[model samples]
Target: MGILANTVSFRQYQVLGDPPAGDPGEWAGPLLAKNAFVPIDSGSEEISSGWVCLDDPQNGSFAERRDFFRPPSLAFTLRRDQRRVPAALLRRHLQKAEEEFLAAHPGLHRVPKDKREELRDTVKGALLARTLPTPSFFDAVWDLERGLLTFTGTSPNIAEIFEGLFRQTFEGLRLVVLHPFARARALLPAKLQPLLEEQNRAATDAVLEQIQENTWLGADFLHWLLAHSVAGRNSFRVRRAGPALMDEAFVAFLDNRLVLAAGPQRVTVAGPQDHYSEARIALDAGKEIAEAGIFMEKGEDAWKTTLKAETFLFGSFKAPGVKPEKDGITDEKSEREAIFYERMHVLAEGLQLFDSLLLAFLEERLAADWPKRREQLQRLLGFEEQ
Candidate 1:
């Protein structure tokens, strides 16, 4: 089963700084209305047209309710409408218009440049007028105590728009992607606090090693997993805070094509399951993992999702089966609440697993041991079998 429904993908972020004082709901009400979405400029190539409240727009009930501070969730809709004037269609129309102009003015030898330009504008305006805007829903849930907010998308572009709009809506607030170091720091033991600080301070001379920004550490971490699949029995483990593990059991690499279903039950695998060999080859050839589908058993439940290599953002996560209501009846509100809780729990475990793996990588293993691990991978893959 797909890990998530309704939402196609996921992007998680931590809201930086403290939340505003007072009832969050009361504070959010006015701001939501002020920054509510409007339609896009149909003729322009702009994508982030405007935002509207998904819960309520005209009535401004979003402000009337107090969910922003208590539990911390905001739902909104973004619209993008674009119309492209096809070169061929515009050319044909212009040709027709030019012929009509010529017919109307027989003395004119050639259509003036200004007249052609005017026709192009006319065609563009007409096309734009007939176009409809596309709407997308963005859900944001903040963990007020933890200063974190997860956006239900992974697109950097969308994330940027969300960041801009969020700041506009909630002044002095910023959303930053929880990088490998930041995430790892959260899971590391108190004794290992120095390791995170070493990395953060850019301590070039520190013995614990440091990570640079924009380094493909997440991809490298996955590659390291492929290399030390056997060593995972002793090498990869996390304890103290919460039980978390990362090994071969949780990873799948998807290159291009994907499989939907294969069995008579019509059970569909979201992506190409048989492409494991191809994925490995792609990795061997130095192509980074575009997407990593991971299944992890954490805190007594199985959670699965596709994680982006660049950002470690979870996408399309599926939790275990849901129990039906005892009376065989459920309301839409209860169902929504149930799914939201499940998603949050599954996402929490996934993040923990991610942080555990990242900590393992940064804990002297990558810098001190990755070279030998690389040789092992090259040998296993027949690149240097000798």
Candidate 2:
């Protein structure tokens, strides 16, 4: 689903480097237009990818500021078209071609390797030309003021493609995945940042190293939240900054599904878990939470998402739906703009609530009395031994 959808799954990226100094719309307008999507329907290319309008994939124009630029935010969609040929069909065609070649030459028992390869290429090209291209659209919203980008897709291959395209389109700028440790460091206060750095397990500044080495951050946070929820301690105060007021009370808990992993083996516990007995068993077996469905609510607003522990990616994130509230709105364009801003507003608020919950966990996890709290949590989970 796209960003406008009621439920969307996405990965967050931290944009690095700086853009050309000028009216952002001035330089960005040309860049988006220059790298706009081109139709591959007439060509036999296997794949093609480029930027398109967020609302209309068929429209790639970015001439005006209203087209893609939304002040400090730029929204666009990455459209990828791919053509595939069945391997079995290709093999059959190649075999028939080889038989025809052998029949034409009476003395030849088999086609030569060079001739066979040539025939295979010809067959593949023919099959590709006859095949229709499948198109996919992934939406992206880049918050220039915050240097953060949210992409409405979670596939690793698609993310790699998006990163490459983003780097190519915007010269000098690159994207860094906002892994657990990086996010933790970003969320920590100035006083606690040094303490977080003290707990860093990665030997290098590489992204993968940061994520793989500090996976405990996510696992322990989920474990803490799970334990708290089981103990009926689901209320927390907002600590990190954003749309939510500081010290505002919110409720968050883990339920519906929980994924636990121990090395190569993994277990998924689904449905409405009463006291999460099955998950507790897995936890006792030394499996750490790799993912879980997190639900947060504050007053009338609510958000739900399956959060991937390692990468902190949100899967099937459902934010509060918004509609145009302006009475007597006759113009479609104005209505769309109104809905867009409302969606962004709620999205930001959801993210803020999540970050606040994480901060609450971090403050406890990083404190000097953490060992005592850990012992208490272990006791609550019936893990008194370790």
Worst 10 residues of 1 by lDDT: 259-268
Q: For candidate 2, write residues 49-151 as lDDT tens digits.
A: 9999887789888876776877778999999999999899999999999999999999999899999999999999999999989999999999999999999
Give every collision pair in model 2.
none
Reference-based lDDT, residue 361, model 2: 89
Q: Model-by-model lDDT, in order?
A: 0.55, 0.90
Model 2 residue 254 distance off true place after TM-score fit, in angstroms:
0.1
List runs of model 2 lying over 4 Å from the truth: 324-329
Candidate 1 matches the true fold with a TM-score of 0.69
Compose the digit string of candidate 1's lDDT tens values, residues 190-271.
8777745644544452212333453355655665554444233323354324334434234322323322211222211245
> How do the predictions measure up, each by TM-score?
0.69, 0.97
